[model samples]
Target: MTTETSVDVTRIPRITHDEATAITAVENRKFGEQLRSLGPDDWIASTDCERWDVRAMAAHVVGGAAGQISPREFVRQVRTGRPIVREIGAKHWWDGMNEVQVRERSDVSTDELIAEWDTNSEKARIARNKLPKPIGRLPLLNLPEPVGRQPLTYLFDMGFTRDVWAHRMDIAAATGHPMDLDATHDGRIIADIVAEWAGYFDEPFTLELTGPAGGTFTSGSGGETVRIDALEFMMILAERTEGTGLLQHTLPL
Candidate 1:
């Protein structure tokens, strides 16, 4: 495995607002359907995420969507030291924001949460596409990897897209329901995630994800190989799996 702390900022590709918006729409639609299918009891069931139940996890996902258009909250979140600023401080920031989001939405019905997600996700999509001059080009500091500052496009495209996907899986696992993952749609997002993961480590490793989202990738010298189901691989990145080597190095998204 390659040991490198610096990420090649130039190597990072740019994503158009149109692409990000499209992906966001897909994630929101499926996520909305899943929320609607939940019974009252299922909403309160516990998820793999500690201290977070089905309802709380949903709130967190909705909060992430809502946060995209909420500049004020973003500022406050940064003040509280979000992970993109310092990965080490991420746990506290994540817990604090999640608690606030869940508590504030406690009185909201599941239907309302779903509606709000749709609304905010659209707003975020518009905002991302129409970001004014300098703002769109501004460097993003909130990232799990300490590679370097990235542009706003990267955050909205890679970060938020994967965030929604990961949480969708969380809810599914918690409620014992299967995800509606489509190879083409979900595959695009997961593929981008794999590309990003490749840039993080210089050590040669091979990853083969087996499922509709399955694919093969090589990083560094491609010496060590990891074979896993697509969903389980994502779970591992979410820190829900235990193993050695790359499995221990959690991806930021």
Candidate 2:
């Protein structure tokens, strides 16, 4: 006989709409700054996402922001992404949407890419924050496997922010650029991730994550003790690097 365990969603700390908005606003600005800092050669640098160079990653980020700017744009992306998803044999429509985003921007200059990202990200932030409550409460379309189903607000608020943040880390790793990290913003984001990760197992553990964005976390009583670099722990949860024991479980960035 076998049994399976699942995350207790209720146990995870919730990020409210207001907090989500603030976090994303900061994250988007930081991401843009990182993009602008990239040298010409850095644009061609390989990231952890094997198929994408830094430019492609930035394009995808811009596309994500653009899609969020309005319902029309989001629908268009979904409609246009269908065929590409099929052609690429991708398991999800988002994969196709990402491809479309990258392909459409392939000819764009690095400067143009950064500019577009800046504009679209700002627009995206406003649109998301102003989204109708009814719509925000609705479930998302084609939710990714690791994340499962979540409200539309989840994508607009936390999901997109996390994606940009993770990509920033990827770019930094690829090009040796220093990340601007602090206790307030990055630490809060990491704490939320920790809460969710701890809930995923629904087990007791003590985790001490080190670095500016890191903190000590515990779930239930002591079951296991773990200590690791904060960013590296995120890498493990994101599956950019293999994890062992409890760390083997993954959550999409």
Candidate 3:
């Protein structure tokens, strides 16, 4: 419920390249399996995100998984967050999203969509792998959020990890598919992103978290106790699930 713009995030935690890559692989497998589980007809059905049917969603999900090269403008947006930047890719990225999107009509069989998705997803991964080493560290976003003058690597990791979890929700919402409880990158990237926002924006929210076993835990709240399920707490922070889901659960926050 809190949406303030000026936060002091100088103290937020950081993630290493090793951890991000490991978590991504874990989430991707869970999501890929979930996608593979769908019957041919199910992929063609409509979902909560309007204008994108299951097939389109599937393609978008897979396509989305493939990360983009960080543009100079994108870097600026993330750090300063002054003006919102539209997501863009290498030349014709627009055409692919708009023109190509229009060309792939529902009449296109689910099998075809699935095949294109498989192919494009591989392409996307290859594209990501080709980026510079520093960029590899960034979280991937379906639409990269703007942060000014800083490296896009941070945003990329945050966006990719969050999208992985969010899309799993999308699949579940659309098909009643059960979510892989351990599907996400343990919300590490998201937690960092939320923590960043907590500093970057003026939001009066406190996240009480349980870190990986034996992992250090820290918050800006001076170690005061706040009750909440770590995942639910993280979800609200990520703005994916309304904290309303926690009404029944005795959340510490």
Q: Rate the local accuracy (lDDT) of all candidates.
A: 0.71, 0.81, 0.48
What lDDT tens digits, residue by residue, belong to model 2 across residues 172-208?
A: 8889887878878887788787776666566677677
| Clashing residue pair totals per candidate (backbone < 3 A) | 7, 0, 33
Pairs with backbone N, CA or C atoms under 3 Å apart (clashes), candidate 1: 1-203, 2-203, 84-141, 84-142, 84-143, 204-221, 204-222
41-66, model 3: which lDDT tens digit per residue? 66766765545666776665554433
- Most lDDT-accurate candidate: 2
Candidate 3 structure, TM-score to reference: 0.56
Kindly report which residue stretches of model 2 are placed more than 4 angstroms away from their true locations once superposed: 1-13
Candidates sorted by TM-score, descending order? Answer: 2, 1, 3
Cα distance off (Å), candidate 2, residue 152: 1.0
Candidate No. with top TM-score = 2
